[model samples]
Target: MSPYDDVEQTGMGTHGAKESGMDERATLLDFPGADELMAAGQVGEPSAQALSGALARVGTAAAAEAAGRGTGDVAATPVRRLSARRRVLVGMFTAAAVAAGAVTYANAGAGSAAPTGTGTRGETRAAGAGVFLNDMSTVAASQSATTGKYWKTHTKAGDTYLSQSMDFYVMNDGKAYKKGRRPDWQFGPKNVDWKGLDQLTTDPAKLLQLLRTPAKTNDIAPFDQATALLGDTPASPKLRAGVFKAMAGLKGVRLVGAVKDSTGRGGTALEFQEARSLGRVTVDPKTSAILEYTFTWTSGPSKGKVTHDTILSMGFTDRIG
Candidate 1:
């Protein structure tokens, strides 16, 4: 039998009590009335699968912690020893599993008036944003990709983090070349080289998965990542189409309707409400390219403050200016 079988088969049995000593006995005292609470409808019972999964996760975390400390001797650890730390971890995991079930059950009985996720909350609002984005995807996919050794862009941008609006140019030929910043050719947030970009999938769902991979060095918000691709990168028409399609799925994103960029170019706008600020991106549907992105602080000392970036021009070129 596997290690999880031991957890399934036994509890504080005679064998466990002998190995665990007084600390385990004292910890057990805290849960003396758990069965009574379950019987009185004050607590819900979790599925066996949920409990098993929780135990497996706890075991994995414990093994990882042990390896990190240079112990690397999980196999040598006794299941019955029940150290205070292990007892707490196991209890917390088990409680979390039960709590998940209880919350689901409670929500099921909450009736139609209960609030829904962004996908269903305001159907008209969500539908409008989704339709516009999907239409842009179609337009983008139909466009032929430009060909050149260097991809170049001219942009003016400012954010709460920057002291003033700065006009800049970025040219990339495998490595990035930019003005008014680093002496190094590589600059700005970490992005894949052309070789890495080629590895990215064009399927909307899969593209989002790759962009949101936890191991990526540029681990920021997905919205920011998508806009970055639409901004300065040499993303192909197909890839840009995938990015637009994927963006329709982001939570809390809604239509902001027609808007004009800093350059007075008309575009469709969509905004996402983040925890502390609101982010809005405007796209010029005519060319299926991003025109501007803005953030307005919703809380903290910078409440009501706004910052923006506007794209003047972007395309692949034979030379850098």
Candidate 2:
């Protein structure tokens, strides 16, 4: 019944799609099995019974775009087929729709549908998502370069008790550290080499290919790919714009008017909700840098469970733990 129910099976938990070579066994004291990535706000779906969620997300975006182009009510856009190019673009947006557990295609007609705008605000929300992302892309492209010997990010997740947290400080060599937890070096370090980040391009098409390549996980889920890309700020302004553009293209993504992060930082957000997983990425309007990811599980015992990974700062540093 809930829109977000489709995301449960492919948990945003610690177990990744298929890690490229990351072998770090992170210790989560209270929140067991929650993937550090998910804690950071990443993941997505399944059928008529299984694939509806993923398909809906894809169809919704396509249909909404179509509705906007026509004179009719958007609700009647009739989840239809996209052209070869659009189909391919849709695949890219949804990580080839791999989040449904396997790569599946939306049937176009029966499988997809867009949310009819509830009223003026709904129309505004739908349209605002597109414009907001465009604004972010513009901001990203206009920014200056920020690089150091290491790229650092602060990740935090808390429940009613003992707030869980860690610092991911990765050196240029790709080896990383958890500054908050002693034993600075992670055990059994997985090879986190992503030449893509270093050789990041401003071209959206090329960058999409690089980002979609399975690195952290074998299955290249676009949502995770996007989140991971946000893990470290792109080395260049163009690449940052590319990241923003790539995100704008995802199928079911939508905007929430205004929100404040756990740290009480206010900003705009975009999200994908399927089954049990609710993934949100918030951005600072002024800077265009992704501030953090927030995840919520809306069903089962984990219902109402929430997690957040906030990026205090991310850039190069000379040393690794």
Local distance difference test, candidate 1: 0.55
lDDT of residue 120 for candidate 1: 21
- Model 1: residues with Cα > 4 Å off, grouped in runs: 1-127, 156-191, 211-219
Q: Candidate 1's residue-wise lDDT over 102-169, tens digit each?
A: 21111111111122223222121112455556556655765677776655556763211110112234
Q: What are the clash counts of all predictions, listed in order?
A: 0, 25
After aligning candidate 2 to the native by TM-score, how far in Å is the CA of 148 from where it should be?
Answer: 1.8
Model 2 accuracy (lDDT, Cα):
0.47
Per-residue error for 56 in candidate 2, Å, reads 45
Candidate 2 structure quality by residue, lDDT tens digits, 66-169: 56566543333322322232433343233322333331111121112222222231112122454455446655654567555544444453111111122333
